[model samples]
Target: MKRLSTLLLTASITASVMATGCIQPTGDAVSDAIPTAQDVRVNLPDSAGEAPAALGEVSEYYAMTRGITRGFNAGAGFVLVLVHAIVQMPPTTVDGNTYTWGPGSDPLDPADYRLTVIDNLDGTYDWSLDGKSKFDPNAEFLTAVSGLAVAGDEAHRGSGEFTLNFTNMKALDPIEHNDDGDGTITVIYDLENRDGTAASLEMHIDGTDENGQAVVADYAYAENQDGSGDFQFSLPADVDENGSALEDIILRSRWMADGSGRGDARISGGDAGDEVVEASQCWSTSFRTVYETSTHPEILPEAGDVSECAFADQDLPELPGV
Candidate 1:
């Protein structure tokens, strides 16, 4: 998470330098041509600073949830960092409404790497990152990333969709240099509403995990003006020790500015057999469990007092892809 914050700051500085140094008085300014890092990046709630002294025990479940949150942020930040480094450079050529930045534009970029940005003339822009093909020696360039951004009100300039095609990029660069997984991760975001209030962002991942298993998941996050936020995601199915597929899992969590939060989880299908299990857990500012309950006691038994929860079960948003 600390690394993600650093990357965000670096991206901001890079964008500022590029905007000031490269953009000219032409009708199309670089600021208006490309999406800002904040416009497309995922924003999750911050974790509590330090555990309280009064809480003797910490909640492992809350810790796992926090880890997952950090994982998503880091994964998304990695692609955004690369995109900012390449696109923020001065373009090598501008043909009509399209701007092209080739290898020499950025010393850090590969000799074969190229980035193109096109103004669609309809309040939208399209961009693609291309690199030399590794599989086909005769092929010149293969697209690794592509996206579109819709021009919105002043408060929400770049609000649209973008995709990172890891499978294609991995074919050119090794998985270690590109991404851990193979396939695509699409992000859709709207930074603000018509009233200028913070809106929502979503990510859909259709890919293979590091272990080569198929993974299909959706994540949604909404922010509140008071620094509180909500996060929801689906857990990909896994196989048990006996090689039997486990159930599908969906979890939603909400946190306040003080770091107290609650999470609700639903498990069904596969190894869950015929019954659907529902569970809820709440943690304090110290990240210690205050209350926990489950419909299926065999899976998760009740613990503590519900009165300690900051938010009720009904407060959580509907689980995505439920």
Candidate 2:
């Protein structure tokens, strides 16, 4: 996912195309209008000069598919791990010193929420997910990720493996199922900023249940499956000629797709060499919550499990170039 995201970040630089959402423009050609999830479902009809099709719903069709049980997750081509889990673990700053969960979020014991990740093979993905909320004991901020899968197209279908790194966040609240395994869900999380900008994940896969027991095909992070213009989105620290602090994540790669998907933010001065930053926008589509204290006990399967599982009704970004 990181690699794919990176490819998406980089894809902006080559050529631009307006994908459904998340667009960044360069000059006067750039319109002030940014695409949003709302624009697609509600506004598209009026704007297009024709009656809009009765699109099901924003979250309905827009839902991201992270599972790979169907195509590439099978044979030797690729083992795409599509993860769609919110980072529930909280982070804290005590006395000015930032404390990061060294390895992962520690158990407060009697964990109310329990998270489990299984694949198409009827087993677990053998990956550890948690929150790094240690510094601020009282206040909680967290991040979480879970089960991911992907399949290649008919021609280039193959298996590929990737890892997810949730940066700058808090703790992870695990998801527990009912008495039987049917209710057990990996993670259905959401997080966003005050502006309604955020992140959302929906992953799928097919593999074993127990950890380290599955045969996963790990593929190298390749840019633009079609050509070199594949790298889509990325965030980095600056390394200018004289060097400066890390800036925001600038939107690079072109919006058009040669298999290049539309990404959220970008890093300025990407061509400036070694310069990067986290975009100022709220790039996460998920909701905001303190996993443990969330509606459900620590973690419960499915968003509905949480009594107050509310996803923000924000608009999706527009890609001008594509």
Candidate 3:
């Protein structure tokens, strides 16, 4: 998926506003309550560059898992575009503790969408993206997206917790431009304490997939401060049409600072009639498979000694509440 340029546009506008002191502090509580874009943004890892010939042939499993990583990043990028659009734009009006942003003075403009940020006055802020209903000719603004962001200390700015609701985004957008699946994604992060060697990000997703199938998944990623990190996601049974005997499937990948990594996949309902199937493959710095093993020999036979693995079982990152 192509990356959205809205974030860059927001950054430029924010910088211009700050430089001109257009929205300077005026003892306005609601204006002061608006959080910066960084407070709510979750930055995902970028895709690895092309593998060099020196690493030999790339492992099929590595390529497959890498694709999944890219897909997750792309999905996240799409959701954040709206967040950036709302948080970075200057509010058009402030009433009591609520700040509003819209196209201009025209209420019946074709744009029709507006954003509101309300200060809870207790370190947490409520926000919503609303638009006029297409079905009703005289409808008021209806919330299409909503969320809450807990304000952190000066050092962290915005880090404790964040939640985003995309259930109505696509259905309620005047132009039907939203691509988010029907669901909510919650993120809990610690910027100060969780930086460097202890860096970590945990996200919980409860919603439907592209096929409108119910899905609940957990994503966890951690960086070792040395450019090495681990990524893992789990899909419970019946998430897809994987058959009646479906069970949870967990895929985990860990990479070193130099780009060498290993991917492990476990399938509970395999082709062999519900028997658990497990596979592990290790790739070189160039992404070439150097070692591979599978319990189902016909599916993914062993290719090299276990000793060839650069990482052991203990190196895998653990998922929360799994």
Candidate 4:
């Protein structure tokens, strides 16, 4: 289970820290039955931090909408082939442009699964699956593109860049609470050297969470020549109750080769005041998990409490391709 979570994180950084769920019944187990993503529009009430409402407000919303750009990659592998094969849909057809499986059993359309792969012939391809009645109304419409090719290995056999796009995702059945609204998220993965490792990636989100408050963010990650990388993010000012810009929030961190890293965050406005906080984390390279961490080392006055730094302490499982 720990390794599964780590593999999910390796898919992209956005997946690492974002938590998705909906408001539900009492116990945690009971509520998780439905995989619902949170509507980030609903944020902390301004009263929670009566002090100028700048840093506090920005931090609260950033924390709320952490997982807006996930879910699409939940089935990242060759999902179309796997899904059809699992259901025993054979009599499959494969051509340069398309792949069709099944004459599915009754109630299931014979061509229950059909995939269209368009080879751009430029070291890239566009693939799409329209899974009508697959999971829900929109489950089958997932689309992806390979921006570049990666060198294949014995463990993992695939080439090219990886990118996917999902829109209006109401089909996911995410529940809303406290007036949070729904929105769309896009993910782009850039493989720096075609070595099957992502050199950098970016996620753009423009949507409202459950709170109905407008939320927007641009997050980017890049690798250094030394095998280390950094994650940086920026949040546009959210609207106040009176419809005015709250404050902008910015965060950046650099992780070393050993998975140890340092980072900082700040909230600023039109010269109202600025709140800054610094953080660091150390991970056990052997175990492939975070072992220790700290936030707000400088103790800048009125920086408020630094948001908790999180590290995955789970054992990483060997995914399909190492």
> TM-score winner among the candidates?
1
lDDT of 4 by residue, 177-242 (tens): 123255555545444335545455555666776656776666665655455655566655441323
**What are the clashing pairs of model 3?**
none
Q: Rank the candidates by TM-score, best first.
A: 1, 3, 4, 2
CA lDDT scores, all candidates in order: 0.64, 0.23, 0.57, 0.34
**Cα lDDT for residue 322, candidate 3:** 34
Sorted by lDDT (best first), the order is 1, 3, 4, 2
Which of 1 and 3 is ahead in TM-score? 1
lDDT by residue for model 2 over 217-265, one digit each (tens)?
2111122222222112222434232355543232322211211122233
Residue-level lDDT tens digits of model 1 in 48-81: 5656433345654465567666666665555555
Looking at model 2, which ten-residue stretch has the lowest summed lDDT?
39-48
Which runs in model 2 stand beyond 4 Å of their true positions? 1-145, 148-225, 249-251, 254-322
Show how many residue pairs clash in every candidate, following the order shown: 0, 119, 0, 22
Give TM-scores for every candidate, taking all chains together and pairing residue i with residue i.
Answer: 0.78, 0.20, 0.69, 0.44
Model 1 RMSD, rounded to 1 decimal: 5.4
TM-score of decoy 2: 0.20
Off by over 4 Å in 4: 1-91, 101-114, 133-169, 172-181, 192-198, 224-227, 235-248, 269-299, 302-322
